[model samples]
Target: MSDTSGSQTNITDGQQVQLLERVSVAVVTTLPCCVFLFINVTMLFTLRSKPVFCETSRYVLLYNLLFADTVQMALGHLLYLFAACRLFLTYPVCGLLILLACFTTTIAPLTLLVMSLERYVAVCYPLRHTTIITIRNTGVAIVVIWAFSSLNILTRVLLLLEFPFKDLESLQMKEFCSGVYVLLGPRSKDYDRAFICVLFVSAGVAISFSYFGVIIAARSASTDKASARKALNTLLLHLVQLCLILSSTMFDPLFMALSGILTRIVFVRLYRVLYIFISLFPRCLCSLIYGIRDQTIRPVLMQHLCCGFLKPAVSNSK
Candidate 1:
């Protein structure tokens, strides 16, 4: 209660607020995502059917997403936790944290793009999917995704850290470090804004077109309405998954911008509240959403978590 009102007091710079938000986000993201990753990794081995080309390629994409998600989640949580405890995102460590956040954000979107592409090939080119989505081909694609992400982040980080500002201390830091350029100064962040706008549009178009092409190509003269509807529902579930991914990423960006401005203008700790909500709720719910929407995914998850519950009833009855 007092935290909100006291936000304006004893505030020489933003370092205190930044520390608070970072710590809060650390707790929110770390435990939930770590548990989710451990369960998913186990299921990949134990629950999934044998690796045919389509299945293998799908798992490849999923593994990439899980790896990237957990990496990003851990980075967001741990880096901030350590920084808050040690105040590391300052002086010598500032550049390093910026570099890492850049890379994590980059990998996240690339993995999503790969998942979309994998689904496209499977749905659009079924007969050829077996040949096209080989282990070697998937390995190459995985390498390309990581390579492209690393290069993109490297270039962007270089551009960001090289901002003409002489004193980073003079600039106001926000919950998200990436927003250093966006609201920290009087000038517009044209370079980053343009870069992000282009990436968002490009990703959006590629996702849309790939799915459209798949649906159109898979359209058949002899196909029944029921089968078509089933295919369409499967696509919807993927779309749902993609929506969660997009929302989760964009939420971080939104908080970054809004928090930078609010703390700058009103001196209120609104960002603190918002940061906690965004970090905890979205990541946890997004992971659980996969289990909720897809019947197959839901059962697979339940079998792992609830098999013991089922066993108790059977034993009692017997």
Candidate 2:
């Protein structure tokens, strides 16, 4: 009887492990990779097909934002897929992935900041907006944003390198991926938290102010109520996008803190599920929002989807 019970227990444990692996691979790896790839490629095609759409300053900025999001998905979530599949990555390769992820993640919020400011100028100072938010200036702003974000992440990467990787080989052998599990000293951890908090707060404040300015301008422009209402709706959409992007970043430290306190298997599983949803869902949401919400892109997207899917059937019938 004792031997039978022990065997049953072992079988149960094995089944549970297999189930967890399957779930993780599906949610974290396969679904996100396919969704991100499809959305980003579709967005690029839609945007690039029209020269006039690409020439507009607002769409140009949005194109850059989409580009940044695509890079972020590639560097961050795509690597999560590799990790989910239990692929082995070298220390240098892992570090480089981390650096690229950090760089792209940082660029996203800053690009949104630029977008908000562009909207602010367009709504508040319409007469000067053409001069202020021209394609050349927008291009310069993108360059500056990228340069700043890259430098910030480069510093963090350097700081990260100082941590000992003595057990990295053993860890990789066991887990088959690094999984962003670098151990930082207390001071280093504190600095990281501080940096993240500051960045979040600063960007959040700037976005808020830009939206507020747009609102004020809208209210004052009594002659152009229709345009004001449209601008307001667009700003609201942007706010939703902002929240989704922030959801990916803001929840991580909190989850890390919870993991330290609640060290249960269930808690770990819940965290994995939540992380997969929060991180990957936003990329899909952002792409969908842009494709559906943008006047210039929406028709183009519909046309492409219709032709891509229906043309094959029509051809076969002929």
Give TM-scores for every candidate, taking all chains together and pairing residue i with residue i.
0.65, 0.80
Model 1, 1-318: lDDT tens per residue? Answer: 698658756573477787786577566645665675565454443225423313466555665665565555555665545533554234335546555655656665565666666667666666777898777888898898778767766665555555566755554433334335233333334555665666656666666776676667557654344434544564555555455555655655675567556654443345335444554344444345544554444554555656435321111110
What is candidate 1's local distance difference test score?
Answer: 0.55
Displacement of residue 291 (Cα, Å) in model 2 is 1.6
RMSD of 1: 7.6
The residue pairs that clash in candidate 2, if any, are none
Worst 10 residues of 2 by lDDT: 309-318
Please list the residue runs of candidate 1 whose C-alpha ends up more than 4 Å from where it truly belongs after superposition.
Answer: 1-55, 79-88, 160-189, 217-219, 223-231, 237-253, 256-281, 284-286, 291-300, 306-318
Query: Candidate 1's error at 298, in angstroms?
Result: 5.0
Instruction: Report each candidate's C-alpha RMSD, comma-separated, in the order given.
Output: 7.6, 5.7
Candidate 2 lDDT tens digits, 1-318: 999999999999998997797576556556656766687778877778877666778777777788878877766665656555557766566767766776777787788788877877777777888898888998999899899888877677677767677845453433333323542455556666787777777777877887777667766734266665766676677777777777776555566568678866766577667765777667667767877866667767766766565332111110
Once model 2 is optimally superposed onto the true structure by TM-score, how far is the C-alpha of residue 129 displaced, in angstroms? Answer: 1.2
